[model samples]
Target: MLTRDEALTLVKRHVSEENNLKHMIAVGAVMKELAARLGEDPVKWEVVGILHDIDFERCTGLTDHTLIARELLKGVVDDEVVGAIMAHNWENTGVALDTRMKKALVASDAVSGLIVAAALVMPSKKLAEVKPESLIKKYKSKEFARGASRERMVISAEFGVPLEEFLTAALEGMKKVADELGL
Candidate 1:
């Protein structure tokens, strides 16, 4: 398995956009929290989250997203990590959501965007200013963070976590790395 530092370095090599990098980091934080809650390996989940979008910048289309990442990460990370990455975009990549990690990855990926958007809209523009309740309120508004898929965010519930609890975990996770996210 790749260490977190090595995975981050590899991500930086592929992702040039600052927001994109921050998004990946935020997702990794959420994945770590989710893994802890579900009794999974936090380091492995975090690394998988960080490397999920390793081909985000190079991909030509939505369908090509994780497909390219599959090749980019081949032999560098374990099959489970790569499979979870591909499963996050399963609709496009045709990967099965056969594990809790894969389902959590999808929710984490979408929720990170919502949490960041919520923080940005706050008066202080800080992660500390955004609470889980506030996130739920923002989530109710379909117009808010439209890009953050509401459907995907609810996938956490499919794995036994309630929606609010999942959102809280995600917010707490992102709060731990607020400075890195520039939130």
Candidate 2:
């Protein structure tokens, strides 16, 4: 498996936009936390999360998103990791959400955006100020964080984690890398 440091280097090489890089890091943090909670390999999950959007900036369109990732990460990571990465963009890639990691990636990817948006709206604009309850409230309001898909986030519950618990985990995970996210 590709190490987290190697994955970060790869992501930095591909994704130049600061916000896009932070988003990837945020999802990685959430994936690490989710993996630890679920008794999975934290490093592997984090690497998968970090590389999930490896081709985001270069992809020509939504349909081309994870498809390019499949090519970029061919031998660097395992097939399972590649599959989870592809599955994160399942709507366009048509990959099956067959594993817990895949499901968690979907939830982590979406909730990271929601959590970041919530912190940005705070008076201090910090992750420390953003609460899980606030995230849940924002999640309920479709007007808030329109890009953060509620449908995708609901996948956490499908994997046995309650919505609030998943939000809490995501909030905690992002908080760990608050400086990196500039939240």
Candidate 3:
């Protein structure tokens, strides 16, 4: 497995957009926290989260998304990590979500978006001011963070984490990196 620094270096090399990079960091922080809570390897899960979208800036279509990531990450990370990245985009790629890590990756990816959207709407525009309840409220209205699929977030249950608990962990995770995220 790649060290966190190496994974981040790879992400920076492939992803230049500021917001896109921050989004990866946010998902990674959340995945680390989720892994800790679930008694999994936090470093591995976090690395997977950070690298999941390394190909996003270069991707041209749904097929190019995870497919490109799989190619770029070959030999740099384990097959499981690569598979988790691809599994996060399972709807388009047909990869089965067979592992808890994969399910958490998918859920964390969507929840992080919803959390950021909620924080942006707050008066302080800070993750510190954002609450899990606010995320819960926003989760119901599809208009809020429309790109953050509620269906995907609800998959947290598959990882043995309740939806509310998952959202709270995600919010806390983003809050942990609020300074880096400028949120």
What order do candidates take by lDDT, descending? 1, 2, 3
Per-residue alpha-carbon lDDT of model 3 for 1-183, expressed as tens digits?
Answer: 777788898899999999999999999999999999999999999999999999998899787799999999898898999999999889898999999999999999988889988989989999898877877888888799899989889999988999989999999988999998999
- Model 3 global lDDT (CA atoms, 0 to 1): 0.91
Residue range 52-89, candidate 2, lDDT tens digits: 89899999989888988999999889999999988888
What is candidate 1's CA lDDT for residue 162?
91
Query: What's the number of clashes in each of the models?
Result: 0, 0, 0
TM per candidate? 0.97, 0.96, 0.96
The CA lDDT of each predicted structure is: 0.92, 0.91, 0.91
**Higher-lDDT candidate of 1 and 3:** 1
Among these predictions, the greatest lDDT belongs to: 1
- Which regions of candidate 3 fall more than 4 Å away from where they truly are? none
Off by over 4 Å in 2: none
lDDT of 2: 0.91
Model 3 residue 19 CA deviation (Å) reads 0.9
